[model samples]
Every structure is written in structure tokens, then in C-alpha cells.
Target chain A: MAKTTTPPDQNGTKTLSDQAYQRLRSDIIHGVLQPDEKLRVEHLRQEYGVGASPLREALSRLTADGFVTAEGQRGFLVAPMSEEDLADITRLRILLEKQALCQSIESGDDAWESQIVAAFYQLEKVEESTDRDPVEWEVRNHDFHEALIAGCTSKWLRRFYSILYDQHKRYRNIALSTEIPRDLHQEHEELRNAALERDQKRAGDAIEHHILRTAEITQRVLREESLQKKERA
Target chain B: MAKTTTPPDQNGTKTLSDQAYQRLRSDIIHGVLQPDEKLRVEHLRQEYGVGASPLREALSRLTADGFVTAEGQRGFLVAPMSEEDLADITRLRILLEKQALCQSIESGDDAWESQIVAAFYQLEKVEESTDRDPVEWEVRNHDFHEALIAGCTSKWLRRFYSILYDQHKRYRNIALSTEIPRDLHQEHEELRNAALERDQKRAGDAIEHHILRTAEITQRVLREESLQKKERA
Candidate 1:
């Protein structure tokens, strides 16, 4: 869990562009940078205290990653969010994650089980704490899910999983609220148990249902938020 | 089909970096650039006749696209190839393409069917030609496949398909030999017929088998090449 959130000092080998890419990606996912916001190189340079060259490089990379959209010479924008986009992301996550979970169940060793236990335990600690930050909770939750698929040997599948997961996280972060709709901890526990038991079908069903359920909640939240915005308008 | 192969003069909106990215990606996929080859920016700048800034930006974007890998400050390299990677890419292509094909079948309009017909026609024409370039065949084949899933509404699914298809193309190009391993024309025809008839299961199975069979051939080629290298050593 400690490895999930990096302190700035730990980035010794990271180039300035890599650092900028991480910062920009996190800001976009966490909603520090609003969706559809124009990213002017000059303005971002001042804001991030990064030079223009590295900033452009970072934005180019993020464009490839789907976090940013390049608008030709006009520069980039934080990719916009939509209900359909969230649904698409959810669909992909379910498809890829289910396959990955089944593979992990087949191949996961004792160390894999220990990682899952540790990740889930960390997530539970955060969930049980009343004063935990939402960002911290999101990080822990991400690590827990990552741990489940850590044993999958297919790099391509894992890469797609990472991309879809990040996109899902973006939607989750944007639609996040204080309302606790589902028993998240229970869901996590079920997923962990299913994986540890090596029940591929149960694990697959658990993750699919978990992701679909989360998408439903997020979609509802998005709808209500859009309606509120309309009312305000 | 013409849109699949870009003519240099028509790239009006493309920046120098975009040009570099396209050139480098095509070279890598076509095996003009060998796997694990170091991409020295200074050498590439001389060869590509592009400035350093845009070249670096292009390389950064390619890194995210998985065609090139950045090694901290050590610069970039063409991503390596392996039997496992081709297997993984084929597996993912089957999963995502099958879904996309189904969605396209469900949602496709008359226009979508027409596009498929046209693309298939072009592909057949290329296949029947006596002096057709392999690159031309690849382009038509790509367009034909693209036309099949053009009606799928999910942008994310299409994006993943594009990525996986490109990676698969890289493997296909590298393992390419003059050997006619299978009747590719017959397979394409079956896929077209299934897609046009909206037979989801048949289309899905056809594509799954098609991709798997191609992977088997590519794997055999890679194995034989490695063996030849060992003999030379």
C-alpha cells in the first residue's frame, strides 16, 4: 500500500517529463484538473513549474494514454467525461479484469495470496477509519484490485487492465460522493475470498458484478449531478 | 481503403511530431526498424530530418502507444518481440474484436454493411493481384477488419482493438514469410459472410479461430528463425 502513493522525493530516476506526466495524469483522474479544460502550455508551465518542452512531452504521452486530447496546434485538453464514456470504460474493465482474475486464480502462488491479503487488509483499515481521505481510500482500493490480477502472466492483458482501471478511476473520482451505496468492503472481501479459494467462476462473477454495480452507482450519480447543474444553469 | 494508407501530401493538419510518430510506428510495425533497436534521437533526427523537440515528443507518444519503450534517461528502444507477446496480443484481439463485432452487428446500419462490402471487395482485389505488395495487402486487410466493427458505438472498445491490432501487425510483419500457410482469402471471405449475415456466434468463432491460426503460424515462423540464428551461432 505504501508503494501505491509515491512521495515526490522517491522519483530519482524519473525524468522531468515523466514526473509531469504522472502529475498531470493524477490531477486529471483526481479531478484537480477539470475535464474539458484547455491545457495551455504557457499556463501549465507556470502552474506546474515545469518547463515547456517537458510539459508538451508529458501532454503528448497523456494523449496516447487517453487522459488528454490533442487539439492540433491549439494544444491539449483534459479528456471530457460522459455517461457513455463511463459505461464504455466499465464494459472494458469488466471484460479484461474478469479474464485477468481467472488467470491469476490459476497461476497465483503463495506470495500472490499474501499480497492480496495485505492489500485487502490495508483497504479494510482505510475503510474502517472514519477520518480516512477519499483519495487515500481510492489508492488503497486500487492496490487491492491490482493485487488480485498481479499474477496474470499476459503483459498485454495487464496493460489493457491498467488503462481501463485508470479510466474507471477517473469516472469513480468524478462521480464520488459521501453516499455509501454498496457494501464496498464486503464486495472486496468476497473478491478476495473467491480468489484465495481458487474458484475462477466465483471470482469472475464477483468482479463482474462488482464492477457493473459500481458503474450503476456512478452512472446514477453522474445523472443527478448533470441534473443539478442544469437546475443551477 | 484509401484512407488507411496515408499520402504524405495530404497530411495538412499533422505536425512534424505527428509525422514522426506515424513514420516511426509504421517502420516498426513493418519491420523497417528491428526489434530491440536503440532509437538514438540524434541519428533519428538526421534520418527523419526532423527537429529534436518534435522527435522526442513523438518518441514519448510512441512509448505510451507501446511501440517504443523509454529507459529512464537512456533514451528509447523499439519494443521487443516474443512468442508470449504474440500469444497475448492474439488472445486480447480475439476477446475485444469478438465483442466489437457483435455490437456492430446489432447496431450497424445499411451504410455500415456497405462499408464492409467495399472493404472486402478491395481486400479481395489485392489478394487476387499478381504483384501486390505485402504492405498493400496488410492495408486492405486492416481496412476490411476495421469496416466490420465500424458500427460498434463504444469508442473505448474500438481504441483497444486498434492498439491490439497494431501490436499483432508488428508480430505478423516480423514473422512474415513467402509461405502460404493457409488460405487467407477463404478465411476473409468467411468472416465477411458471417459479419454481413449478422451471425454473432459464427463471426466470433470465425475471428477467434482466424486469429489463433495466424498466431500458430507466426509462432512457428518465430521458432524457426530463432533456431536458424542458433545454428549460425
Candidate 2:
């Protein structure tokens, strides 16, 4: 069993497994481990300074989130990404996002609308600070979209959205390695405006367009990479 | 390492891990092990007549399929279901199914159309049978929907759809203890007719309606279950 080791946090404590889980999850998500790379318990224990038990538990949780795959005694590996998966994930994201926007528009209160506006403002700020670093902007961008759909009453819808968003982030990172068109910011602005005005149909359309555009761009990049690899071979 | 045991067959080969994976997957999916139940490796190894390595490998694969949870030294447990998860899964299924239907409609050839018709006919026959065994109907019903989406080109979309479908099956089984009013056969017919006629809009609408209706029914049942548990307490 993992021990609950919280070092005098005044009010509460955190478990060793929790720490391991967060560390491993971030590593996997941030591409530290690389997709489809084997996750060896012995290596992870040495790297994270955690016991094999806690490390195993963390990997287990990651497996549940679709981020990792356990290959039995062969150990764990980061889940692989492909052009096909990117397209399917994007398509599903669009569908759920549109429905979520509609529901949010129908049920969102003044607070929700204001939050949308605030998130967009922050997003715009992040968009302008391109020279600072892409990482921070990427985080803010995720927050902005999450805020957009925060008013949805369905817990399940939100959870699915989160999963899709995480998957999208991985592909987006890949796209960022290439030349990205500036039109994406403008599209985000349009989506924000539509959401602020509670124009459900317009918001839905904007969201779909935004997602599909990224998918198209990502797919093109992936194809180019494949071609480059083949040329090298 | 799990050894490959050769059972005296023409092929003369079967990996222990592969055998373990198949048996564990079926057991988990078929509800031989209840949700949120702990999976002890030693016990499982003895029970399945497999070694530790093979059992761990099987668990790893099961983890990828969202069937089990790994909790460090606490070992593994079946993934738990919640009402929130159920709703989210259904919403996702609806979204993916709608896209698949759209794609199927646009890209489905004569064979695809015929499959839909054939599946619907078989589905209707199964539904009309007086046995009313939920298990039998459930299996046939899944086959019918899968047939409807068979024309979809995206492998990722189908994979995600299948995952959501399986998750929904778990929840639906729970929901079955409660009374359901709607006739699922009618809904299937509407969806089939729309698809056959290439009425994309109608088909999409019917798909959405069918999914939401099921969600509503399941939600009601889950709510009742919660209430009953509360009263019992």
C-alpha cells in the first residue's frame, strides 16, 4: 500500500501514489517519455525516486486515462498517436463541443458569459505574447476553451471534452513544430464572440470549423513527416 | 517473462500472455468480475492457472481497454462506473455515431446500404422474439449499430465508438433492473429507414434522438438506484 506522506501541509496531506501519478502523467503528456515508449518500473523508480509499487500504481491510473498502455510483463508504454486517431478525435471533439456550446448557451448565466469574455481576453493576451514562449500560451489556450464550456450542466459531457482536449493538445504540439497559419487566432476570436453573444448556432459552427481546421493542418504535417522519413530511409 | 506454450495443434503455438489476455478480457467484459472489485495477482494467477508474468500482462492489456485500475501496491481493480460517467459516455457515443452515420451516408456503397438493411431486418427479428433476455438482445443490438457504422472510413472513430459502446453496455446492464418504456425496435427502424433513403438530416436527427432517449432512461434508472441505496442505508 502507498503511504500518505504529506510534509506538514498545515491542513492536509498527499499520498505517495498521488505524487507519482502526477509526475508520471505530466511526463507522458509533455512528451518527456515519448509516445509508445516502454515504461520500465525499475527505470521509473530510479528516475522519480519512488518505489516500484507507487510507480506501478501511477502507471495504472495513466492507463485508465488513455494516456498509457500496459503490455503485461513487458511493462507500460505511452499510447501511440496516428493521423487516423487525430482525425477521429478531432471529429468527436467537434460534435461534443458543439452540443456542449448549445447547452451552455441555453443554460449559461451572466457569470458564465463573463467568464467566457475573461478567458478570451486572456487568450488574446497569450496570443500576443508569442515571443515569450509557446508553452505558457498553450496552457492558457487550453484554459480559455475549457472556460468556454464550463457552463455545461452535464458532468459526463465535460469529462469527455477534457479527454478530447488533452488528445487535441498532443497533436497541437506536433503542429506547433511546423509553420502554423495566423488565421487560428482570428477564428478563436470569432468563437469567443459567438459564445459571448449566446449565438448557439454560430458558436457551434465556429467551434467545428476551428477544430477541423486544426485537424487538417495536423494531418498535412503528419503526412509531410512521413514523407520526410521515407526520403531519409 | 511469460512463455509461449505450444498446445498440440496444427499451428503448434499459443503464447501464455496471449491466452491470459483473452481470458481476462472476456471475464472483465462479461461481468464475471464486478466493477471496482480488486484484482489480486497471486489469486488471479492461481485461479487462471497462469504464472505471474502472464497475469500481469493480461492485466496491462485490460487496463488499456479501461477495464481495470492499478493502485500501486494495492494492486488492480475493475474500473468503477458512475452515473456521471454513464451520461458522458452516452453523449460521446451519440456524437461519434452521428459523424459515422454522416460519413456512412456520404461514402456508403451498395454493399453498405444492403448491410444496413440486412442488419435492421435481423435486429427486428431478434427484438420481436418473446424471450426478452436482455443479454441476447444486447449482443444483437450492438451488432446492428456496428453494422450501421461499418462504412465509416476512419479507424479511430470506430475504435472510440466501440469503447464508448462497451462502457454504455455496462451502464445499460445496471439500468435494466429498472422498467424501460420505449420500444427500441421502433427507434432502430426510424434510423434504418432514414439511412437507407440517404436522408442524412433525418438519419442524424434520429440518431441523436435515439441516443438521448436512452440516456434519459438510463439516467432515470440510475437516479432511482441512488435513491434506493440511500433509503436502504
Candidate 3:
């Protein structure tokens, strides 16, 4: 599993709770832990090979991260995914990403350009490879997008962008195999070229379209799945 | 102290950790707990009359909320405040709040207008009073702003606006006593009127100006305080 985007501590160590938090977050995002699933402390403790204290601490942190929902004294459950949430997150991603992209294009230095090129190259390699590990693609794809906005000076915008990106990823992962065929590589290529050329409007539109396209596909998949579940019921 | 904006759960009962979370969050926002201060689990336990378990859980949650910073095994500390952070947060608040305000004004019904009027009435009552409690003003002020945006259909936008508003409050609280005199009540009235008239541009501009005006005051106060501290050092 890819470690969380959050870096290690100053001393380069991950505490047990931190480890648990990352594990649980990764599981939730990857759908290993299904949405709305109960996160029983006993079950997680045995599953994760950790004690109850660390597991509980991890769940508490995840609650704040929106990966888990606290049920008063009843304990915690994985946050449910829905079409409304996906749409909301996607809209936000478009808003913040466009703002950040504009800022990056306006003030990005040569170093920023190099970073974007390097990240995109790595991502493109993985995309072109015959055997693409979804996990590797996830990391590389995230890195490529992060590079695009690395020049935005606003920390708060960047922070929210990261959060929205991760939340959107949960939906993206669920729709990965189920999505309609599209030229994702071409989409990224257009974004990269526009960003590198400092074409703010083009870059912004590319990103907005990219995000909306995925959201549309994901929403459709969710709708179909829910309908099938209803029929089964 | 005002209860958190987060409503109680379905059971209408808060867990011990939830209680601790509210108290700690309030204290931090009110500056009763100093920024960057080490949150000794033992000290917080004694101070809040909660057990270590609940306190730890609260701290964990607060770290996610950005009210506290987790320092690995060293435990958590109150999140530090700075002029730069305040500026970043204020900028985000403006962006999100304006988006929400425009949407609300565009779609608001009579019920939404009534909410705004009621909240404004309560806020004005406190603003016009001689013996105004800052705590009461805070609650009413939050409600008034919340009411203006209540008509917005996008829950994600509202959620982010709330988060950014509370984060900005930490700075606003610190500068409350030191800020220059301004007609805050008048600003709100302008916003309320604009919103009620369904003037999207006017309401958006009013909120933008209102937030920027306070941010300017708070930034100046923070700058002067930092200078004084430097001189003393």
C-alpha cells in the first residue's frame, strides 16, 4: 500500500497510531474497508495486530479526516460514499484546482516547470507500461497533479486541494475499472502542455473537463450499482 | 461557552471525547489555550475533568481539525497562529464564502430570507447592546453568517466555508480587543439587505469587504505584537 501523502515525523519514525491511521485511511480509500462498514475496535485490533488503544486513536483521527464517522458512545463507522458527496467534492476540486493552476502559471519559476516535467514523465511511463499496478499509477498520478499546482503559494489552497483530491480519489478508485473508455493520457498531456506554456485558460479548462468527465462516469456507475442492489433486495 | 457549530448526534447525547473536543476547540479559538502551547495529556485531563483516554481522543480529533498539531510520540500542541496563516485562511474564507453567498442569493426562498432576518435580529440585538458578551456575539455572528449561506444547495461549499470561518476566528479572537473601531453591524446590515434583495453581486461584494476589513485589522495587530515580542527578545 502507498503510504499517505503526509510525510513522516521529524525523527523519521511512524508511531503505531500513525501507522494505524495510514493503514485504515488507505483501506477506506481503496474500498478494502467498505463504505459505512462498522469499524469495530476488537476486529481492527486483531486484524491490524495492534492493541485497542492505538486502533481507537487511529479511528479518532480518521473521524476528523472524514474517513470515519463517530457514533457517540457506539463507536465509529467508515464514512458512506454517495453521489451527492462525489459531485460536491468534484466541484470543489475544480474550483480550487483552477485557482491554484492559474497562480502556478502566473508565478511558476523554471524549477516549477522542471518539477512538472519530471512528475509527468514518471506518470507517462507508468501509463504507457503494459503492466500498470493500480497502486503505482495512483501514486504517480497524484504526484503529477501535485506537481502541476506546486507553484501555488497559498498553503491553505494547497491543503484543501489535497483533501479534495484524496476524497475524489475514493470515488475514482471505485470507478476505475467501470469507467467508460477515454483518452486520459491525452487529457493529462493537454494539461501539462498548457501549464508548461503558462496558458492559464487552457490549463484551467483542461483540468475542469478532466475532473468533470471522471465525475460523470463515476456518478453513472454509482447509480447503476445502487439500482442493481435495489433489484437484488 | 458556545457549543460547537456541529450539532449533536442522533442520540442527542455527546460522548466524553466529544465534550473534551468542544471544550478544547473553544479554548483554543478563544485563546484561553495559547497557540503552540504543549497540550500535556495530564494537564488537559485535570483541566477539563476528563480521563486520559477521552483527552487523547479529543486531541487526535483536534489535530485533524487543525486546531492542534500532533508531534508524533511527543504528543500534541495547540496549533500555532501566524499572520501568514491568518492571511491564507482569510483568503480561502473569502473565496468560499462569496461562492456560497452568490448561490444562496440566487436560489434563496422566503424561508431562507426569514432565517437571515431572524439571525440578523439576534445578532443586531447583541451588537447594539452595551454589555455585549463576546461569546454571545460570536455565536450570533456565526449564526447570521450561516443563515445567509443556508440556501446554498451545495453542502460541500457550506462545509468548507464553515471550516474556513472557524479557522479565521482564532485570529479574529486574538485581535478583537485591539482592532480599530468599525461599523461591523452596518456591514452585516448591508449583507443582509443585499441577500434579502437577491442581489448576488451586491451580497458577494459585501461579504468580501466585511471579511477583508477585519482581516486587515487582525493582520496589523498581529504584526505589531510580533514586533513588540522581537524588541523584548
Question: Candidate 1: deviation at residue A82, Å?
Answer: 0.6
Docking class of 1: medium
What's the lDDT of the predicted structure labeled candidate 1? 0.89
Fnat, model 2, is 0.30
What's the alpha carbon RMSD for model 2?
A: 5.2
lDDT of 2 at A98: 90
Put down candidate 3 lDDT per residue, B62-139, tens digits, no spaces: 887788999856888899989889988988899899988888888889999999999999999998998877789889
Question: Candidate 2 — what's its lDDT?
Answer: 0.77
Model 2 - which docking category? acceptable
For residues B116-196, what per-residue lDDT tens digits would candidate 1 score against the true structure?
999999999988888877878889989999999999999888888998999998888888855443578888899999999
Model 2 regions more than 4 Å off: A1-21, A35-42, A51-66, A69-77, A178-184, B1-5, B8-89, B178-182, B212-233
TM-score of chain A of 1: 0.91
> What TM-score do all the candidates reach, one by one?
0.92, 0.77, 0.92
Steric overlap count per candidate: 0, 2, 0
Task: Provide per-model DockQ scores.
Answer: 0.79, 0.29, 0.68
Kindly list the per-residue Cα lDDT of model 2 for residues A85-150, writing each as its tens digit.
887788778877898888888888998888888888887887777474677777778888878888
Per-residue lDDT of candidate 2, residues B80-184 (tens digit): 877777777777788889989889998889999888888788778878877666666777788789878888987656766777787777677666655464698
